[model samples]
Target: MDVQSGLPRCSRHPDVETGIRCTRCEQPVCPSCMIPASVGFQCPDCVRGGSGTGHAPGANQPRTLVGGRLRTDGRAVTKVLMAVNLALFLAVHTAGDRLVDRLDLIGHAYYPVLGEVVGVAEGEWYRLFTSMFLHQDLVHFLFNMMGLWVIGGIVEPELGRGRFAALSLLSGLSGSALVYLLAPPNQPSLGASGMVYGLLGAWAVLARYRRSDMRPVVVFLGLNLLITFTRPDISWEAHVGGLVAGVLLTAAMVYAPRARRELVQYGACALVLLSVLGMVLVRTAVLL
Candidate 1:
């Protein structure tokens, strides 16, 4: 109760008046303290308490903001991803351009070693995924790995390991699809830029959802966009595609109806992949 106005105050915020009560503890919670749960809005304390500490086994467990299970090692998935990218970079350095040509994202190109035309249009669809881990040089590899370390570390805990991995791959694939559809058939592209940009977009969305200051993210994104367009070497298509996909995917995860959250989130991911496949097929047909 508030001594000033004689009205009930939120447990978390003494100055804020609120009539809404948490579904679990029956404690009054202000709008800022309310978190959407499977049944109804709950306070942060109740959500944290339900994390399998003293609660009975099989009791309705708490979920993350995006419906993922809470984890202690939030950056576990990020480390693995970075390792994969680093391993692939080493392999490319050892094997040289032949390996790069074989693994890089290309629409269609003639390889002298094979003495024939090959590319995604010729059914090398795996390139779309493999190319994500390839990099041009030491600088490129370091830059992308650092980004994964930071952004993936932030997003993985919130979305869980599986969901975060799925988002990264799908976002990269979206970028590859755009490059395939728009770039010259013989042109080649590779890097984790798409995936990094995707994670960046997800970070922005998360910040917005939490009602945090948006200026920092907005300014950073703007700077990146400026660099993407100004630099001749950058693949704007990949950056733009990944950014768009990340925004949409994160939105679906965070804003889905609490009644069927997992279904809606994973379903959105599937739809994005299907859309990418459709784009690939159409582009392949045109190339062929």
Candidate 2:
């Protein structure tokens, strides 16, 4: 009896045929060789590649499942991020002042008592996360979300959701932190611009790390930075901080040892988050 037809033989284990394809590399794998992951099955080789998969020779191997679902073979995460931003924009507009006020209360607001941190100086510190969900106005929201839609669509599918999420959260927090540290005492800031900038930075780094042509990223980043500095109402602090942090964090993750890169990336993000929190605390103390 040919077992290969009944159960796909594990590419790694000749004796074992579990009929499972690695969600990452799509290599036939046995249950014993299959490694369970947050998104889906990942073989040992794919797991070891980490963010460096695109650079690996065989990394392009077809994926059977991703994030525990049948592969759509499209930029699902990018589409979702864009949809969320658009939906939130409509909600904020439709809800009007009521939504803004509510978001201000729970979202990141300029609070002298809380200083520059997202939720740290105030009980609503959760705003660090929530603020990313809110936008200052329609134009502001649309522009930032559009950037995310474009850059995220390009990067998320390549980097995967976990890395993309980390980039978004860290960039958002970093942007907030910059505003907290550098903005006027009573000034308040909110938007997804910081995260968008972070995505730009990440893509720039990814291009270099993967040795891909970076002309597009460089052109885009340069144009945005120019706009950021020239625009009077723009939160330049958030843009600068998030961009810098994104670059640094991406560098740390890209250059670090593969076995330890994820840990380092998480640690780097945590440190930035804490730094933002600390800035808020100091500001609160100074005001008090």
Candidate 1, 108-163: lDDT as tens digits? 99988868898999999999999888986899899889888988887887787778
lDDT of 2 at 186: 46
How do the residues 1-288 of candidate 2 rate in per-residue lDDT, one tens digit apiece? 753467667776777867576766667768787789755577777777634333345553433211212334446666666677677677877877555444541323454444454433455556555566677576787788778878887767655666667777788788876676667644556778888888898889888988999898889999999999997878888788788778877777667654575677678878877877886677656544
Best by lDDT: 1
lDDT of 1 at 225: 93
**Cα lDDT for residue 31, model 2?**
77
Q: What C-alpha RMSD separates each model from the true structure? A: 6.1, 10.0
**Which regions in candidate 2 have their CA more than 4 angstroms from the true location?**
1-74, 105-120
Pairs of residues at least 3 apart in sequence or in different chains that clash in candidate 1:
none
* TM-score on alpha carbons, each prediction: 0.82, 0.68
RMSD of 1: 6.1
Compute the lDDT of residue 48 as modeled in candidate 1: 77
